[model samples]
Target: MKDLFCLIMAGGSGTRFWPWSRTVKPKQFFKIFNDESLIQSTISRFSTFISTENIYIVSNKSQSAVLEGQTSMLYRENLIYEPVGKNTLPCIGLAAMFAELENPEGIMVVSPSDHHIHNEKLFSETIHAAIIIALENEGIVTIGITPNSPATGYGYIQTAEDITGRNSIKQFKIKQFVENPTKSQQPVTLKREDFIGTAVYLFLKYRYFLNQ
Candidate 1:
């Protein structure tokens, strides 16, 4: 698994978080729970499974200085600087290029730098499983988080019948990626077990990762 690579998406300024999370310091850098900021926690959590050198953080040029200062202990070369924010698709593409340059057959894991995973062990196991599935088969793998609440703020993922798994990481033919619904179109009630795409994707093959 030396070719295994982790792409940490840390570009967003997280305007939704408001006053506390500003442009200078986004939600990912916010210390919501522990002394460690969200981005720091993300790097620390994954470092236990993957080497610091294998982890690459994709962030905007403005946030590069802050990210560098915060993640100085980690491999500095792995920090990928994006001149602009082009959303996940383009960011993933850039990371794929970097991974391919390092190792043509590299397997890349893309994840957000702001999420809070309560179960680190489970998350790691799930990610590993997804990596295996993605490598064995030519398909995109995404980690779907079981929604804890009826979040109108998040988009929902409807899994295909063939995809089956106890954990959130399951094979799904992405039915439809729904955006956050507005108040007028909001449903009366929402379920807790509803699945939502965490934007955490796994690319098993470098070619497949780059093409997608």
Candidate 2:
């Protein structure tokens, strides 16, 4: 089996949460849902398939202490810090560089550190299915959530008609990405086609930015 490297992005200041989540201890470090912090839970979710050594955290230098305290179970060297917060792309690129050097042919999984997932089993299954697609193909595989309502905050992905591929996995060719569509743009009723974007994605062999 090829190596699977997990990069947990946790560089956000989390100003949205405000007073409850401060600069030193952001939302990722907060135990809002349960005893374990969000970052810890995120690590635990990946730990089911990926080893602790293969898992890495990409965060701002400011949250060093808090991040260390929360996820001390992982290798100390796995913590890659950004001098300043440059958002998701930079964080992912920086971590991807490290992962590339370690194992250029390895699969890289990029995920946020603060998502609240209710169904762990289903989430894992979806991720595994995405991984299989990535391994067999030469493109980026992202997990999509089926939308129940017309939520403006989330970006909607309109997938192409089913091509009768992957019997178990509901796979499709992405037709287009509509970011935060207005009421006028969204359909009256979301059918079997609508899906919301989840940041969680897998890169086949660390050449994520490249095309076939």
TM of each candidate vs. truth: 0.86, 0.87
lDDT of 1 by residue, 42-115 (tens): 88887877778788999988887788889986787788888778888888888788878878887788888998
Q: Write the per-residue lDDT of candidate 2 for residues 1-212, one digit (tens) a residue.
A: 33788989888787868989877778999998999999999999999889888898998788999999888899998999998888767787787788777777778888889899988877777788777777887777776776666766556677777643554667777777777778776574255445555444545557654322
Find the 10 residues in a row with the least total lDDT in model 1. Answer: 185-194
lDDT of 2: 0.77
Off by over 4 Å in 1: 165-171, 184-201
| lDDT values, one for every candidate | 0.76, 0.77
Best prediction by TM-score: 2
How displaced is residue 161 in candidate 2, in Å?
3.9
Cα deviation at 198, candidate 2, in Å, is 3.4
